[model samples]
Target: MMLIEETAVPETALPVAQFKAHLRLGTGFSDDDVQDAVLTSFLRAAIASIEARTGKVLIERIFSWELVAWRTGYGQALPVAPVKAIEDVVLRHMSGSEEIADPAHFRLEKDTHRPRLMPVGTVLPPVPSGGAVVVRFRAGMGAVWGDLPADLGQAVLLLAAHYYEYRADTALGGGCMPFGVTSLIERYRTVRMLGGGVM
Candidate 1:
């Protein structure tokens, strides 16, 4: 299976000013604006890292996932949480033909941490001989910064501050999560079920 981001979170959606406030960086400094651009990168990186580790999108964006088959006949568990909508499902046949599944035939069983695509009736569309199914959808808390969970927002600011302070370190290892950041996002880590199902 492969998951690809269809659209990225807009920079405007990032709460840079609020993050700065969290860091206690006063706006009176001459370099405040310059620092904002630099800090924006840190915030974006922190948010991306947190999302990667947690398997949860902290901001709204489109994502497409490809799979050979469903985990169960009932439905397939999506990789990301808080799925807002199922954009479309495309079936690719071994013969190289493609068809878009009718949205009416399937529905999103939205959940806070796990969402699944469930067929409306007894069975889903016929599977292709060798090709895969591509499902596209939107997921996240919301498009705006204020829509983020308070703890998650705090975690992003804390982690970004960490990155900002260590900007001169030059040799920090990748995937390094500070204790506080981990504590904030630990509960969000997704636990997959048997047969590649997500819990």
Candidate 2:
């Protein structure tokens, strides 16, 4: 009765050893980090299930534009509009709620670029499935904002799972492995690559 029930196909079972290795490489927490550990486990399982079902990996791009205007005591300071752009490149491979699938994929792609640095008119790389998912994700950015609510921790876990699936898929597809797991991984990698290793 699940949404993906009809389309679910038996997947090549994920190897336990490989899964554990992936967990180690993808996350920085230890087993003592109960919250992170649990979340990571959930993400891995969800990703494995989704990959087993769909032979093709779902790839997506993530982009965002933010315009803010502040007023000073003076004559408005020429509007002072500051435009910031960010991305959260992600791949949604986990077969979970359909609503999340789109957003998950988007976060994967957006994670690739340096926020507020990529030029406004820069061209983006094409994603699988003709970019439909990416377009939808970008359009839904407003909804994904805010603290990922503590009550919605389970939902966050599901999103994390889809993210992991995307990373595995991209790696298998001959793309460079993401810095770690989700867009956060890209953040860490970007910083390190820029010569800002651990403060």
- Cα lDDT, all candidates: 0.87, 0.28
lDDT of 1 at 137: 97
Instruction: State in Å the error of residue 166, model 2.
Output: 20
In candidate 1, what residue range of length 10 has the lowest lDDT sum? 190-199
- What TM-score would candidate 2 get against the native? 0.17
lDDT tens digits by residue: candidate 1, 105-184: 88999987778888889756656768889999999988999998888988999999998888889687877879999999
lDDT of 1: 0.87
Give the top-scoring candidate (lDDT): 1
Each candidate structure's TM-score, on Cα atoms with residue i matched to residue i, is 0.89, 0.17
lDDT of 2 by residue, 83-122 (tens): 1222232222234212222322222212222212221222
| Reference-based lDDT, residue 161, model 2 | 46
